[model samples]
Target: MGQLRDRLMRRWTTARWTRRLGAGAAIALMVLSIQPGLGNVTHAKGATVNLVMWQQWGGGHEKKTLDKYIGLFNKSHPGIHVSEVAVTDNTKIVSAISGGKPPDLMDLGTTGTLGQWAHDGLLQPLDTYIHSSHINMGAFVPAGWHAVQYNGHYYGVPFMNFNVGLVYNKKLFRAAHITHPPRTLQELDTDAARLTVIKHGRIVRLGFVPDYPASNLEVFAWLFGGDWFKNNGRTSTAALSANIRALQWEQSFYQKYGRSSVKRFVAGFGQYLTAADGFESGKVAMMLDGEWNIAFVKENVKRFQIGAAPFPAPAGMTSRNGTSYIDTNPQVIPTGSPHAAQAFEFIKWETTNPALAAEYATLVVNLPQLKHVPQTSLFKDPNFRVFENEANGPNAHQLPQTAISSQFATNLGNAEEAAILGKSSARSALQNLQKMTQQEIASTH
Candidate 1:
């Protein structure tokens, strides 16, 4: 009976040992699974990584086109799932980042904003990624490459490029007995004066209005051999003589056509997107606009006859004929993105793959930043050719990359408006703008 009891006791001890071993093993596994960067424990092959992207192109066909490409990317990359969210207001993005929940990828609509963000240390420097992917920085147009850079570090990738050009009405030019588009600033001014039509002391049609549609001080300033900054964006040049001259030139339009009359005439125009656009309806003969205008004209005005030309330069400065305000929307990764490497992979694929790049640009009717993509048949249409040519031109430039770039632009706009409205002389307005921009720069530092 004692021998039988010993056997039963031994069996009980063995059972208890087995249970303890099993529990210990289970605990180990639980700890391992929670540990980070352990292969198979934290992330396994074929495991899905979800990423979110925020973009400004959320309306109309832009949204549809972006979604189509995103869907294609997801299908092509089974392990990576990218969900797109449309966020047009940049302030929202700022708030998200400050809250430590920024999207994995963001498409800020201008390089200026990208520069400001990068300057604030809110972006990831892409040098390592660029080197790992063997991206040829020279493949991008010089202006585009310049746009995405700040303090010698690249924080964004160029997506679509657009430049200002002189879009004119061919029918109107022919009616005015002008055989060719103006080649110089003087010619443009003379053409505009001749094209101006006054009916019974009321201006019926205007040939050109400098501040119509939108006022871009950079456009006019660049055309007149002036820039907002000097010494590689280290100093404000708002009060320089060249910029003053540019503002005066803009004010001349209001001076020539009484401001009150011009204001009343401008009020008569309909919204820009509709068929009654001043340029489309023969109310304005010439204007400085971007490549996207082609798509707008094609969609809205069926019978419109238009001609695209390099924006004219000052007469003696003929070299600036093709000089334009080249702008780009850069794709960026926020600083705290968990899937930065994956986001960059996507950006490299989208920007470097000629076929995909061309497809995206074509759908949006924007110029592809890739040198070869612009040569594709999709961009060979005459309406887009002029912009493509200008993209390669020598004088294409982006706004200066400064921390206060947006504020600087706003101040310049205010100065231009003040000058145009005859409230202040061009010199005084620019001087005040320079003082304000300087103060902003100092405060930011």
Candidate 2:
């Protein structure tokens, strides 16, 4: 799915729905240059595996960590050399595969890209080598593995996982003289009101931004006894209507405080976590963000008393408790890499090693992906355990890992922006979006 992902990146990042899903069989193809010299290393001296891995974070620390992995790979397997390069965008991976110089392995955070690449013939299947080595994939969560499969064929190996939580400002709550965090839905609303502040006819402090990132709608819907798509627990389109819940939630906030006031208050805010970041500046009381923010906020904000809790439903609402969401960072071996054997070895050693996982997780503030990484006293922060347990729990689902995931997320985000802005009625907005989504999915098949 080289070009497919390129188009997806364009759509997903811009929140545009794709217009075409064309499949023409028996297209012109360039055969792989079968370099027996490259694949055959039995008698070769120090055969090197050149690798390029892409991830969202691209600072020097992440670079050093990857360098460490290559260092270890080279140290143990002197005969099998490894070279590492880091990427900021997965689009580069697209270029490499289509250009026929694809990296030996890719770490795309889950099965979606792996499945797409494999379906597009960019990825080579790993089942043969996996069975031969008897690799125990049980250590990784089910969602990543499920994402890696396409019609029973596994194309990638998973690396890590993470979950979301309701992070709040504790100092502000205490300043408001509220002693305890909300337990029930009603109590949360009451606490929110007390925590919020208005200045000069503008909301300087917002209780919560229910529609932030739009992905929260899915988690909230799941928590509030709403299903975006559920057929006997097999499928989901939950994000679409989370916009409805968001609209209702936002509309309620608007009713309590006029829409004009809410708009002006929101408009004055800066980006999510930067200097103008509402949470970082204490302008927003509560938000739904992922596990990495635990370390990030601790490092960035010095004076704020930060705490986290599972989001709650309104008073007397009967829905599942602690029903949260997971945003995983999974790794996969691409389908058409020239160095498949070396790639598998690298992933097997890295993923299976508890020590390295703990180290990386520390830097990123996510739970160790390994089954054996212990939660020691040093790592025993309250919300840290919450994220870890949720990641490995029954509710942990690697977000919809479909080949069409980019489209779904974009459409859902669009629906969310529209709903929050009151550009269209909530029901009509979703109905149009779902109809469009169905059309897009059908075009693909």
Candidate 3:
């Protein structure tokens, strides 16, 4: 994309987007073999390919950006029509694919769902088309394609990307008498204690509590070197001791102040976009969260001194350069689609054609998966480059790419909850996770 950066300053795309070729449109752009205007377009001759897309990353605005790509694709290739159905929620992709019906294309949110799909034989490999088109995989940022492969075949074509980090409040830290944000677990604990405020036996404030449900727990698990899977990611083993340590750290606050009290406070917490967020209302001193919240914080929470840093680690442990990242959304083409060939043609044009990628990305904030696309003002922020850097950082680990990854996540969650509730020890949880995950993998086959 470095060359794209050069072309970008002029605000022009390196690829052409046009319905009719006047002189130089690439032969890569193909209309439906079934020519249109002969009969009702209800049938599929030369008609535009119908595409159903699932948008998993970014906020609502991200969906709008993808839709704009559809608009551009439609305008440029009037012969090939594309229809998009909006679906977010990165977690449910397996169900969507395994439910025996899947969209023509979907964004797999760096969730490792693409790998799983490829392994399950649910996704078609595009190597044939890619090689023929001379598409350079090198143009995309590494993470965009790293997790897209499983057992040597690639199922997904990369789209947008993201990375998670720590976001906190400067005003809240100052009020808690914390001069510096925590860099280690000890400091994190000390800051949490200072930030905790209780009145009438009711908790008024708490520190940045690790919201385990949100994938931040994975970062902590990585810290302890205890992964959620076993056997090179063919099975789940979420009950690892590292996982237990992480959960213990996560639940430590509730244990310190009392879960009941914390629950009561949370029950009354207000809207997330408004003042209800702990960082927004001065209710929390720190947080381990994602980058999108940056826009939300800047947009919704005003008059508060906010800042972000890498998550603090335990003593002698340095928070790594990147994180337990799930970035790079996956765009897949469903099998048995009537417009398979046409759909593929549109995919090649939309993803490989720098013009549509640049135009669509202009409105979307996520990093474009297409190689050579530039980071532009279209993202609405200059600091977003930080997220892109983080995605390329070493701390990132591809989530287990297997058909049962979704189920493994579920089992891993149970192990996490068991430890959180004092129902089991971390060691036993890990062992049980291993056993159950192995069973699930065998059963799925």
Number of colliding residue pairs in each model: 0, 8, 13
> Candidate 3: where are CA atoms >4 Å away?
1-46, 88-102, 110-112, 115-121, 177-180, 212-215, 235-240, 267-285, 299-306, 319-322, 353-364, 370-386
- lDDT (Cα, tens digit) per residue for candidate 3, span 67-127: 7777877888877777665455432444344332355565555645565556666577876
Candidate 2's residue-wise lDDT over 1-445, tens digit each? 3433553454354322221111112222644332211212222333544444444454445556667776887788765666555554555566555544466666665444554566577677778867787777776656656656765777766566666777888888888998866766667777878888878766778777666523466676566666555442224454454546644665565567666676677777776555467777888887777766666676567766778776665566634445676644555665445557777887778777777777777776766655677556526878777666666555554444455566666777777567666777667767777677667656656
Per-model lDDT: 0.79, 0.62, 0.62
Off by over 4 Å in 1: 1-46, 198-203, 267-276
| TM-score, candidate number 1 | 0.83
What's the CA error at residue 401 for candidate 1, in Å?
Answer: 0.9
Candidate 3 contains a number of clashing pairs equal to: 13
List where candidate 2 sits over 4 angstroms from the true fold. Answer: 1-46, 58-66, 80-86, 110-118, 230-243, 254-276, 317-319, 392-394, 397-399
Superior candidate under TM-score, 1 versus 3: 1
User: Where does candidate 2 have its weakest 10-residue lDDT segment?
Assistant: 17-26
TM-score of 2: 0.79
Worst 10 residues of 3 by lDDT: 32-41
Q: List the residue pairs that clash in candidate 2.
A: 109-330, 111-147, 123-335, 124-335, 124-336, 228-237, 228-238, 229-237
Give the distance in Å from residue 421's predicted Cα in candidate 3 to where it truly belongs. Answer: 2.2
Q: Give the best candidate by lDDT.
A: 1
